[model samples]
Target: MASGEERYQEFAPPPALRPFVRTIWTYAAPDPSRTIQRIAPDGCPELVFDLGAPYAEQGEDGVFRLQPPALFAGQMTRPLVMHPTGPTELVAVRFEPDGARDFLGFPLSAATDRRLDMVERLAGFAPPPGDPAGQVAAFVAWLEDQRRRTVWWIDPVVRAEITAAETEAPAPTPASARAASAQRALQRRFADRVGVSPRLLRSIFRFRRVFDHAAHPGEDVEGWLEAGLQAGYFDQPQMARDFRRFLGCTATDWARDQHALARAIASQARVAS
Candidate 1:
């Protein structure tokens, strides 16, 4: 982690076609009195560095709680709990699922996908706390180098299929025709690249979107449901199941909890007790 005295390093994603997959630098002040935690029910993976603090990672408990200045480069297949000791600072590369696959050189299903979990494999790598800045600088330099290289590494046939699907703009027919065409193209692309059809992905995406929207008082549920439907769920039941999978709760319950948590964050600057 770079010290407050050293400099706060922030990296923004380049502007272009794949804007959503941008990797940015994140920083925080060192505070001995505070802990930072994150949880992911949807199985989103991340790359992080643990500067050099004592930390504990819970196994078989479905939760990972860490005490920092430790550096880690890993993926979270389940929920995680993190704590920072003495106001730590660190650089993280956050990636979406597809972008993560591109960056990691392995599919998400690969057991050895996490770099930190196989520390021995990362032999000759930088040590923790003392060299995070150099590590991040090296990563940024590498990403810049890769940016000048090729695009879309899938097989030629798969790339053709992807290009065709993305080109299938909504037809000029009736509303249903446009919707059906768009849905079909998205489904094909998702199956080819993401290993899941757009129908399933949209259900998950919609459920997550609804939860995020309803994470406040006086939110409109009916409107949220309509939005979910537009995002391609067969109906509300499918969407609800998605909520259960990623959030470990029904839609309504998850919304309430998020709202309460947000209120607490805004009120006293506290983490979950």
Candidate 2:
């Protein structure tokens, strides 16, 4: 993170593209440090175009390499650590849950945990401009043509299964024999379209829900227990395990840390809650 105030802004795309694009954001970290940003899953995929200094993605092997200027990151089940070398500016699009599959012209499951270049994936497309606003216009032009020719390949059963899974929370998952068959079909189709198991998606949502609780004006054992329960965890132990699993940090440690992601999540979660 930059010591100096950073400029972070977000804008909606053209109305015609609203269904696919969640938002396009621009971040200008003019006075960047070697800040390590920890990214967690929010059940959405993204396309980020770097317009400033390049950043690196820390590998599982403890190595860090500069990320591609333009990359398509799929449904992330684990955390990603990013390190910026200097001043950094980013133009990024956070896609709607099912949006990336259609816009990217490929099943999302194939892209999980991978960083890819748009030019390599799609022909006749070049790297973007130096400005965020300009890049967006260029992207829109590319997408307009794609929208007319590309056909969405999602399976009907996969859609229904996901719908059921998303809605099943306050309710129980299906138990009937027919429902079991549907579940199996859903799993196969979903894996085809989204690339992750329904069970994994559920876990992502569960872990992310705790971000809101970090903003809750509570603390200690009692607050942790309540927060875990609210986030759909059966108990503190489960939530604690998840914090370690995805973030590699304990729940309490994360709460006490000074990170932009956690702070922003807390702020947004408060408003949403």
Candidate 3:
């Protein structure tokens, strides 16, 4: 792929901001000539600051539109394929399921499947060129300034259930009369603050778990099926259905294709500069 290679790294958030931020990261796609990467929903929202060449997004209508250098790319219900105009570099913040509502100071509904410019939204926080670390640090300062003004719209129980569900916990069902009441309350709070039902979030993460568990490099067909079942699938057939619904491919094909789920977002490519 020449210098069109992708290079990426992840960082932990500062302790004070750990409650809202998931992982901070920087990705560089040097000399990204004509290649574009496919980005799918991993059940999380992000704020991206592109510091290199801009990329073009392919719409459902088959048109390619240039993406803003700094923008809030909201939660996606489906896949997005972006075409790189040239070399690309970006620093990003991955937020927890219910984190962006307070961190970004807007309802999740307004940002879903949309791109809102960061400079216009944040007010005077423009990032200088080639400074990935500084970009994230500045956002941290903004968050710190607004820390006291944050509203606790999401209940702690709701946040806990969301975190559990995202980490591959089984979905809540009718356990008992009292337990069901608590479950319903959490579900309602989740939908209000997170903008989706808890069940849907659980399903998304569950699908992702199958892919992560099944991804064994250079494995044979039987190895693939065993991995999928081990990842909590009922059987091979159930896993195939999930792959089709979430990934538009069979589990067998997914294993053979060598497309890691991380490609849907970023990668740790070592480019030959």
Candidate 4:
């Protein structure tokens, strides 16, 4: 089996493309003859565009399978969504919470099936012959066009209207001084539109955010524990409980898994690029 780093190396996105989107990546079959099994974990909502011939996706239940036509984006809760062992290439977009909200016409708090027909239409596109640069240019144009449409379709217009109706709608106060202001914005925005308060979102967000630090490979968990305290977790026990609840593992296990994957991706990315 290929390590996560191996998989990442095979599919790392071009460095030049990172600024345009959050971690856009492409994964291709590792060997021309062998199939690659992809296990996608529960994560931020994402869009996947197929660049090769269409392929099969095993449903969550595993009893059913389907061929995804070209472009699709939705909530992914399982580990193995696409088990493509054949020749295939994909472009994946992982959106930020607010960006996801603006892009999907829904909140990131829920798993949804959002299919943009235009994406598939564009995926069916054929890049000009002979120039790899031309093909990528064409694909980038289609991607930007869809991104513009998605942003236009959804913004906090409805939420803004509701906030306007309530006379006391607290003017977007800065979140508590104890918590990072950005964290507070994530909490408030999620609560207003997603129906869950930021406190709840923080439990999940913090669990994930620790990864930002933990991915460093040598950072001690003690520092993370202390950071959690600063981030407003009542205590280490409280933080650990939340990790088990949302991430399905203890902090140590979660950090290790992500670290492993990060290492794998970083190493493989060099070769893939």
Candidate 5:
């Protein structure tokens, strides 16, 4: 088995593509253990091109379905559980929160929690044939071509909401009447473009910060009370609630269990930034 560091790598997008593409990443696990991996939600959609043995995702019914070689993974509100079928190699594009809509030319809400075959969803799309690096280059070129042919526009309100959700500013107060009204208007457009409501996106963003805090050098569960506060949680219980909601476990339990593979991928992959 490759070490976590060797198993994953992330590459930045070109300047012109940065606004739409968050990052391109590759993961290879040639001899993975028979352990199920739980991937937490991060409010971004992905285009995955599997180059080696496929992985199987567990559906809500608890049945596992083999993933397609090339597929679009839409925004997920709950954790996704998957186990390897054999050796695995994947090169994937992580799109910005609202970027997939412009590329897919459909309402992202239609894709939430769904993985659509890329070739079926996007005409003429296919998994680029090459090694990981060459595949990434080919995919980026394809994306650039698509950008030129497509007329793309992002809603300003959604942009502002994403910015506010990702900020480290103090937990926001209750919304004002006018702000609430504006949020209602934004929710429809946000859901159409981003696959989740603005409030849900904010919750997911805040939930991700808990991991960031726990990852800091010398931080541990002993200090999670403070970590939770810094992560915009009102208290440890509030943080624990979110941890349970998103991870299906308490923070302490999650730490004790040591989900190494999931942690490694989450730490290395810049899904939304």
Candidate 6:
């Protein structure tokens, strides 16, 4: 089996697609030793094209079922546990936080935490036929066509809220009687476009930051408590709460668990960035 870094690769989207597309990535591991991996939420939706054996995802009821060969994964609120049934080869597009709706032509909230058959749900959309690189090229061309046909727009207030959440800024305080109305409007716009409320997005971002700290500790960092503080948590207990809610495990337990594929992809992404 190839090493994780060698098995996975990421490519940049074209300049024209940068506003909507975060990245296009490929993963190929024909004989992986570690099969199961827990993938935590990252606030972005994805379009996945499986060129090799399909993966199986574990449901809340603990049953594992095969995933569709081509699928659109919506904004996820919880971790997704999955394992490849055979050889694994995939090409995927990761969209910006509020980008998927423009292409799908529906409110994003409808697909939250769900994976839909791409060709079935998306009229006139099909995976390009070719090797991974050729398929990516074809896919990019298709996206360019879609871009030309669609009118692109994002609510300014929702855009600002996404920025604030990513930066871990404190929630804004209502200044007047109309503030409540304005806040509701923001929430509606955000949910329709981004598939989650601003507060939940903020929490997810903070949780991911803390997880990153755990995955790659600095030389001066002492422990998880310090990591939590660095990640904007009030204390260790608060961090623990977030870990339980997002990962279904305590920080210590999660650290002890080996999620080889997930960890490797995350490390590669950090390096690429």
Task: Report, for all candidates in order, the number of backbone clashes.
Answer: 14, 1, 0, 8, 0, 0
Error of 2 at 25 (Å): 2.2
Q: Against the true structure, candidate 3 has what lDDT? A: 0.65
- Candidate 4: pairs in clash: 5-264, 5-265, 9-268, 9-269, 35-85, 36-85, 39-79, 40-79
In model 2, which runs have C-alpha deviations exceeding 4 angstroms?
1-3, 119-138, 153-181, 215-221, 258-273
lDDT (10s digit) by residue, model 6, range 1-273: 334433666788999898789888877766654456777788889988887778889998999999998898989898888887876677888998897888868898988999888856445545543355766786798788887898766666677767777877754543244468787887788789999988788888888877764455342335767767877899878888887777777655555563555666656655753
For residues 94-191, write the lDDT of model 2, one tens digit per residue. Answer: 77666778777667888887777763544554435445576667667766677777764445555555555455443234535447777787666666
My TM-score estimates for the predictions, one after another, are: 0.52, 0.80, 0.79, 0.52, 0.86, 0.86
Compose the digit string of candidate 5's lDDT tens values, residues 134-194: 7678779888998899887777767766877878543233346347776676778887899
Candidate 4 ranges with C-alpha deviation above 4 Å: 1-23, 27-44, 51-89, 101-139, 147-171, 174-197, 214-221, 254-273
Error of 5 at 56 (Å): 0.9
| TM-score, cand. 4 | 0.52
By summed lDDT, which 10 consecutive residues of candidate 5 come out lowest? 169-178
What TM value does model 5 have?
0.86
Cα lDDT tens digits, model 4, 1-273, are 242222332222344333234455555443433332333222344555565545555564665354564543543322333344445455556543334554445555554433333354554576553333454566566666666665433235434422332222433433454468666665556543433443343344444444344334555768878777765567888877755555445556544554223334333432332
Worst 10 residues of 4 by lDDT: 3-12
TM-score attained by model 1: 0.52
| Residue runs of model 5 more than 4 Å from their true location after superposition | 1-5, 121-131, 169-174, 177-181, 213-219, 256-261, 269-273
Candidates' lDDT values, in order? Answer: 0.44, 0.68, 0.65, 0.46, 0.76, 0.75
TM-score preference between candidates 3 and 4, better one: 3
Q: Report per-prediction Cα RMSD to one decimal.
A: 8.3, 3.7, 4.6, 8.7, 3.3, 3.2
What is the TM-score of candidate 6?
0.86
